[model samples]
Target: MRAAIAGSDAVRGTTSPNPPVGCVILDAEGNQVGLGATQPPGGSHAEVMALVDAGTKARGGTAVVTLEPCAHHGRTPPCTRALIAAGVKKVVFAVADPNPAAAGGRTVLTDAGVTVESGLLADEVELGPLRAWLHYARTGRPHVTWKYAATLDGRVAAADGTSRWISSEESRAQVHDLRRRIDAIVAGRGTILADDSALTARSADGTADGTSVDRQPLRVVVGTGDLPEGARVLDDAAETLHLRTREPSEVLAALGERGVVDVLLEGGPTLAGAFVQAGAVDRVLAYVAPTLLGDGPVALGASGVSTITGAHRFRVEGVTMCGPDVRISAVPDRN
Candidate 1:
């Protein structure tokens, strides 16, 4: 199962709207025979690929997969059918299929005389590479990860609004790597007017590594303000969407319908405040610099929490040092 999870991680960015699944095949003697991962959208599923790699060795063998074999047919045939026809003796899976149309794979396999075992390293599989798609399937909304950089005193910009390079170059590079994984990158019209950021997933030197990124994420601008004709986000590097709304739920719902599983929110303070106040933010990626700006704009605008009792709490998931800056990752504490 661990090997299966590793296979899932290898193709994370390319399989949006579909979980990046992994599979490993073992012969009757329990020796690993083949390994496979989900291909890009409309390509072969992980199980089929593994079966093909195993060939005759797949008959009477056990299959270990990160996600349950898909039971329904969409762009391809049902994975359960494939496994049954391949004469697999048993199946072990990590996570259950959350889609209603694709559920019940376990029943299908069990009824076909194949032993089925579930929840093997399930937490690791669900929270690791499949986190975004599982969240989207359960909530019917894209998982939003709000990312920002601020000073030691929590200032995003200086008092004069000249916010340039608050965090180190290393932290900025990490953001580009993150941008390559998500389905869309969103900002407000205010940010577009102020920074005119290109928002493409590129290195600090402004070059896209074609080998890793076949397509750039969708660039999105939200708000009622009109954008200039030559906004950098409107460049032909990638398709751009102007939502013309300030509500976070509306933006997420629209993106969800478009098959967007994850969203990277690069919006400004006011827009970030709206998402926070609306409880739309699922995760937070904050980079804290060592410098202090006593009087300047904070990282987020008013979130309507007047007192400490009403404060939004987050549980720290990780803390790391990126050059001279500290990168903190957290998720909302809903307890």
Candidate 2:
């Protein structure tokens, strides 16, 4: 199950809207035969790929999968049919499919005389690779993670607005890795005009030259404004979309239409505040440096909170150190 979960995490950014599932096949003697992860949209799912890898060895074998094998047909045939045809004897899955159209895989497999077991390492799979997709499936919207970097005093930049290198090199590299694992990276017009960031996921060593990695997330610019000519974001590094609106919900709706299940919100404070005020941000990833800059803009702005009681509260999920910076992960305390 852990191997299956790792396989699912390996292909996070490629599969959006569809859950990035993982599967492993063990022969009748309980020896590992094959392993595979979900491919891109409209492609074969994890189980089919693993079955293909196993070939004749899949007969009378057990299949370990991260998600319940999909029962309904969409872009491809039902995974349950593939498993039955493959002659898989037993199925062990970590998480159940929440989408009604894709549920009931266990029942179908059981009726076919295949042993089915679920909830093996369910918590690990849910909190790791399946977190964003599950949230999207339950809410019918893209899951938003608002990421920012600031000083100890809560300032994003110095007094003169010349902001650069607020976090350590380790933190920046970690953010690049995170960008590569999400569906889209969203920034506001203000951020583009101020920083002219390419928003492309780059190799850690290539960060200085703006060289993009092979698989880059979609670059989404929000707000109704004309981008400057020859902007780096307009280059052929990755796909770019300029959304002509400042409404957070509108932006999310458009991205959702494009099959974006997870979104990384890297916009400026105003844009972040807008999303927070709209209750659109689902997670928060903040990097705080040790230095103090008391005279610049804070990490967030005007989030519709006029009093202490109205404050947008969040529960800290984790705190870790990245070089000299402190990384904090949290989610809204809607409870």
Candidate 3:
């Protein structure tokens, strides 16, 4: 199951509207025979690839997968049918498919006399690769992770408004990697006017690798503010969306209509405050540098919280060192 989870990570960003699944095939003697991960949209599913690799070894073998095999047919036949025909005697999966259109694989396999078990390492799968897609399934909107880099004292910039180099070079590289895994990256008009960022996911030196980025996430700018014609985001680096609205919910709704499942929110403090006040932010990624700015703009603006009890709160998910900085990941904890 752990190997299957790792395989799912291989194609994380490429598959949209489709969960990245992984599969492992074990012969009756309990020796692993095959392994496979999901491909892009309209491609063969993980189960099919593993079964093909297993060949004759698949007969009477146990198939372990990260997600429950899909039951209904769309671009391809149902994965349940493929597993049955492969003579697989047993199937084990981590998480149940939540998408209503492609669920119920467990019942289908059981009806076909194939033993099926689920919920093996379900928490790990939910909190890891499946986090974004599952959120989309549960809510009719994209999962948003607000990302920001600031100094140790919660300052985003210096008193002179020179905000460059708050975090280390390693932290910036990590942000680029995060951008590559999501469907979109959004910034407010203030950020666009201040930085004019292109928001393209690339290597540290700002050069495209030519292969990994077959498709780049949509670069989005929010608010009714006009941008200069020479803005880097206006170039042909990737597709850009200029949403003339200040409402975070409206922005997410528009992206959802375009089949966006995950979004990296890179907006400024004002925009972040709006999202936080409206309860639209699902996760937060904060990079804290070792330096401190005595007087500067804060990492977040007012979020309608005037008292301690009403303050925005998040549960810490992870904390790690990124070169000379610290990266903290947290999720909304309303309770």
The TM-score values for the models, in the order shown, are 0.94, 0.97, 0.95
Tens digit per residue, CA lDDT, model 3, 189-308 = 888888777889987656776676566789999999787888989898888999999898899999999888889998799999999999889999999999978998997898999999
Clashes of 2: 0
Off by over 4 Å in 1: 206-212
RMSD of each: 1.7, 1.5, 1.7
**Residue 42 in model 1: lDDT:** 95
Instruction: Indicate whether candidate 1 or candidate 2 has the larger TM-score.
Output: 2
Evaluated with TM-score, which candidate comes out highest? 2
Screening candidate 1 with a backbone cut-off below 3 angstroms (N, C-alpha, C), the clashing residue pairs are none
lDDT of 2 by residue, 167-250 (tens): 888998899899989999999989999888999887554463444455889999998989999999899889999999999999
The collision pairs in model 3 are none
lDDT of each: 0.91, 0.92, 0.89
Model 3 bad stretches (over 4 Å): 206-215
